[model samples]
Target: MRLSHLADYAVVLMTAAARYPAGARLSATELAADTGVPLPTTQKLMGQLAGCGLLTSARGAAGGFALALPAADISLADIVEAVEGPIALTLCSDSNNHECILDAHCRVKPHMGVVGNAVRGALGAVSLTELAR
Candidate 1:
């Protein structure tokens, strides 16, 4: 599955935040400048990430953003899910299954379960700290 630009930027932003000398708060514009991402997009992603609990935002002169938890405690899947929701390879495999016509008769549901588990496992193997490194 291809990650959207927003998802890519989210990773970039999070990784950059991870680089800070722990507890260092950085503004969206600062993150954007550091990562070469557009300022507006970084601001939007920062708000979304903060809302998702992946980031904590402080207000005032020293206001900025920082990870809510340690980099090691956060997984890539957590970031992906926080920004993009569940990881599904197809509509039939989606948790909602709202658009699947073969919900009952699909022969691949069992196999898809295995595939999904493997995918999640692989993603879970890599933590945000690993990505940051």
Candidate 2:
């Protein structure tokens, strides 16, 4: 499945953050310029990332955003889930998703967890350190 533009933007923003020295704080405007993502989008994404615990935020003259964990500890899946929620390829596979009309008889739903787990596992293998390189 294709990533939404927002998810892709989050990846770009995160990769940019990963390039900085550990615990380095960066402003959204700077990252917006660095990654060519718009200021509004960058600001929005920065807040979302911080809210989801991927990034930490502080206020004051020297305050900005910093990665909550080191590059090696943060995975692509974490970044993706921060902005896009879980990585369920099919609606039937999501634990919170119960609106599917086919849930009652769909035989494929049970097996979808394996597929989703595999996809998530693949993403989890790619770290921000690797992506930043």
Candidate 3:
């Protein structure tokens, strides 16, 4: 499945963040300028990423945002999940999903987990360090 534009923007934003020196804090405007993402979208995404524990924020004259973990510790899957939730290829693959009308007779449901996991694994294999480069 194709990723949403917002998810793609999140990845672009995150890779820019990962380029800063270790523990370097950056503002949304700075990230927007660097990554070419809109300032408002960058601000919203920074909040979402921080809420998901991928980023840490501080308040004051020196306040800004920084990655909570090293670039190597963060993966493409983490960034995608931060903005797009879990990487389920279909509704049936999601554990909390029980609203599918074909749930009772769908043969593809069981195997969707493997497909979802494989997709997520492929994303997980790509680290932010690699993307930043």
Candidate 4:
């Protein structure tokens, strides 16, 4: 399945952050300019990433954002999850979500976890460092 635009933008924004020297603080405006993502989108993403503990933020005249973890320690899955919530390929894959009408007789429901895990695993194997490079 294709990633949503927000998830894709999170990856782009994160890779741009990963390109900076470790612990170097950066502003969303700078990231927007660097990655060509719109400023408001970048700000929203920065807030989301920070709220999820993927990025750290500080406020003040010198306020900005920095990676909470090293690039190698952060996976693509983490970035995607920070913006997309969870990596479920189908509604059936999420144990807590029962909104799918097909849940009643779906034969493929049980195997959805395996599929979701495989997708998450593939994404987890790719780190921010690799993406930035």
lDDT of 2 by residue, 25-108 (tens): 999989999999999999999999999999999999999999999999999999999999999998778888678778789899
Tally clashing residue pairs in candidate 3: 0
lDDT value, residue 4 of candidate 3: 88
Each model's lDDT comes to 0.86, 0.95, 0.93, 0.94
Cα TM-score per model: 0.91, 0.95, 0.96, 0.95
lDDT per residue as tens, model 1, 1-133: 7789998899999999998878889999899999999999999999999999989999999889999999998888777777888877776676674766677787887687678778878887888888888
Instruction: Evaluate residue 87 in candidate 1 and report its C-alpha lDDT on the 0 to 100 scale.
Output: 76
lDDT at 32 for candidate 2? 98
Q: What is the clash tally of candidate 4?
A: 0
Q: By descending lDDT, how would the candidates be arranged? A: 2, 4, 3, 1
Model 3, 4-40: lDDT tens per residue?
A: 8889999998899999999998999999999889999
Clash pairs (backbone) in predicted model 4 = none
**Segments in model 2 whose C-alpha atoms lie over 4 Å from true places:** none
Sorted on TM-score, best first, the list reads 3, 2, 4, 1
Model 3, global lDDT: 0.93
